[model samples]
Target: MNIIALKSVDLAIIALYFVAVLAIGFYLKRFATSGQDFFLAGREMTAWVAGLSFLSANLGSLELLGWAGSAYQYGILAAHWYWIGAIPAMVFLGIVMMPFYYISKTHSVPGYLQLRFGNGASGLSAITFAVMTILMSGVNMYAMAVVMKVMLGWNIHFSIWVSSLTVGIYVAAGGLYSAIFNEVLQFFLIWFGALLIPVFGLIETGGWSGMVARIQSNFPGQDFTHLWSTLGNAQDNPMGMHWTGIVFGLGAVLSMGYWTTDFLVVQRVLSAKDIRSAKMAPIIGSFFKMAVPLIVILPGVLGLAVLPEKLVPESALQAGQHSYNEVLPLMLARYMGPGLLGLGVTALVAGFMAGMAGNVSAFATVWTYDIYRPYIRRQAADAHYVSMGRWCTVIGLFISIATAYVAMGFASIMDYVQALFSFFIAPLFGTVLLGMLWKRATGPGGFWGLLAGVGSSVAMFFWVKLNPGALAIIALSDHAKPLAEDMYRALWSCLINVIVTVVVSLATQPKPLSELKGLVMGVTDIPKEQNVPLLHKPAFWAAVSIAILAILQWIFW
Candidate 1:
């Protein structure tokens, strides 16, 4: 708890890192002269920058804290949440979703929705995305604040405000360009900082063999021994630990939702200058995702081996209590020397800032393009619209900071935030997927499907809240408790939504075939003359190879 007393050098490094991030923001402003440049990085990002930005935007303090707490409580089974949930979802999105999305040339997902579905569907989805992004932004801010509070001994509110303001200033000034540029820097720092904990942890515990021996000696028959087995069962394992848990916990749910559907990530791909870049962005990031468990989750396992009983403290036994979220911070405090600790702390701040910037940029895009442009006025100059976009960024940052303050009351910010998203995401994804793939899927169907999915997800959420014990019964009958509840509600809701949308759209009267041509063809007015051949060559295969390597790591490592 007295971490600050041990590392003045580390704190200084962290301070310098913050200054560098702000500097990067200012430097990127030159490119952000127009609204498109500000919101979408002028559609000129390379595959690597796009990829890193996508990863950094998605990887925030919440992931660091959540992974640590999950590993602490559940052992190895926690890794599944990332592997099954995120990686495949991302790959699928890149291969399947990006080509069409890029072809559409829309600025945001909701912008695509309007073109594909209609004004009603696009408006509703945009509003939903905006709300979800705002909520998620707050959750990320709250986690970042907690890290700052623990590492720097700063007041939580002040830390949140400072972090918010720093991110807001640049985002408002330069928009997505600033966010993406900072993201590239933050991604490396986060990767390095994350990697260091486990490296130092291994050294502190002796080595991989020594760490394994210590784990076996102390917590015999635990699945934490293998990385693959820790996916989903991280929270409730009776055995030492199971790789299946890792597969499910990290793999299935989290990965699928985040990689495939989340606007924060897809926005990066959508902003790419060309299809090849979009395809490669998530593919490149997948490698980073694969490497994360080694840096993030392994430390928790190492914590079990290295920390004295007193350090873990009993209060920390609960999922969200005693700041197990501080696992990385505590490990850095314990093992890192002064100057290095400052660098590590700086990396942490960078990760948080990158996440905030990404969210702010995404929020601004949604508000300005999707909501503000359509409803507020039909005609506005590009300059005027661009100025309004900056205002939206500031407004979004304030809303998120305020929400972060409210979220501090929750015991587990990650769980609360994810649960909140689940209510809307399931339905939204259902509608989007259907709208994209199914030609018969009408606007009414999309709208009703979303409504039905939301209604069912909400009803199920309340049902579980009201009758906690019933969940146990449902769990026994169901393969998974949390997933079962979610799937049951989501699937049924989607089914109803899809059915209603299809039936109504067909029955009410289909739009004329000529009118439907644009929607069905998935074309935009942008030039197709200069289209680059889909990079279905060796580089594409190499990207695929890296993704396979990631999977293999999950399986074997």
Candidate 2:
């Protein structure tokens, strides 16, 4: 059956959503004339605005479709990405890193690297990030098109082009403000659309216990409800990842790399109106982020309980049939009727646009501020930079349209994203972490260490492709999927970055402490959440958040 079960009311709701998005774009255009306004929303966003945008930008079609599909394929182990892989890192950003980021007044993450390391380090990061951002945008575009093609029977090319054009027009006109507002709007719509699935699903399956019972009956001997139980070994788990890989690779390296350094989300928090607001943004986002698994992951678990045939490993190879990626859309089609169905489809579409917009906007900022201004045109006017940002948006979307085809080659959107992160973000995070905390890290050390890490990561990636069984340290099982390869690859890359940075820094001259002030952890004065009660303090809240996560993990285990 076609996923488009929309009626007149449903079509109206979807139409109104598009009109509302365009209206927001037009409304915010005037405010985005200046460079800061265009790139950072004039640094005037409140905590709620920035926080919601922070969470919502990440709650894209990638998260909705990709992770839901991951859940269907890998069971509760997929929840690790949301919980252990995210919450702590987000809290760490709010409490530990935001002070340096805000105080330095860097326009982007690569801009921060320029201050802490040097332009060489920053330039490498900027170009790499700009490429990754557009590729990620492509992933969102491709994933959305695939969903629409499967569910609505729309032409995949038509879907991609329409979404690209719509996102490009609005984002070009209004800049970051348009992206954030639309992201917040998309957030609510997705929740309203997706919440019904779990609510109705739980009831249909007779609640949590009953759902578990049904999943077990459908796939006996396979535990789909426990998060950590399957992590005893690579082959024991549904993800084919051992606890070391999950904890160290994904939980520590990739999670922190993404939450702490990825400019696509960090740019949202950096736009906060005040230091307090900036600090509060990620903390607030972590709260909402914690609840997102229910809306996304539950649908997959429910699919396991009721739609097991669609998730069978060989089912996709049978041709002209649904696969794991279709699980969310399939669930929506099964549960939602006309008007609600339209709303649900709109929610998914909104998510795709939000992801694409996040990447493109981040790319524009990095291109204009980090690359174009410094390397290309050193003395351009603010208006010129703003214009450049607008142009980059258009070009970036076109590049994204091209990259979307690359994403089509992957087994799944989630795998492709993880691969990209391993290639860039893991090593990038190590460089950033050393630069931020270790005052001894010289510019040369930072630059060369990053290069070595990236080079070695690429080499190892090919080595694995040639012989997956060779990496016993990574616990690469013969039956393991690409996701496991990504995890271990990230772990090795991070280790290489850290070791090289440390060794090279020791052999070189350290910058003066004066130069390192407010940049390195030792010399930097951490900001306090002043005048707030104990419960309101960031440290206290971080502790509370960690406790909650631990309890949840234990329960799920």
Q: Which model scores highest in TM-score?
A: 2
Cα lDDT tens digits for candidate 1, 2-52 = 456535666667667767767877887777889889888899988888888
Per-candidate TM-score against the hidden true structure = 0.87, 0.97
lDDT of 2 by residue, 446-491 (tens): 9988898888888887787787676654545654677877888888
Task: Tell me the whole-model lDDT of each prediction, alpha carbons only.
Answer: 0.69, 0.88
Judged by lDDT, which candidate is best? 2
lDDT of model number 1: 0.69
User: Model 1 Cα displacement at 247 (Å)?
Assistant: 8.2
Which consecutive 10 residues in model 2 have the weakest lDDT in total? 308-317
- Model 1 misses residue 439 by how many Å? 1.1
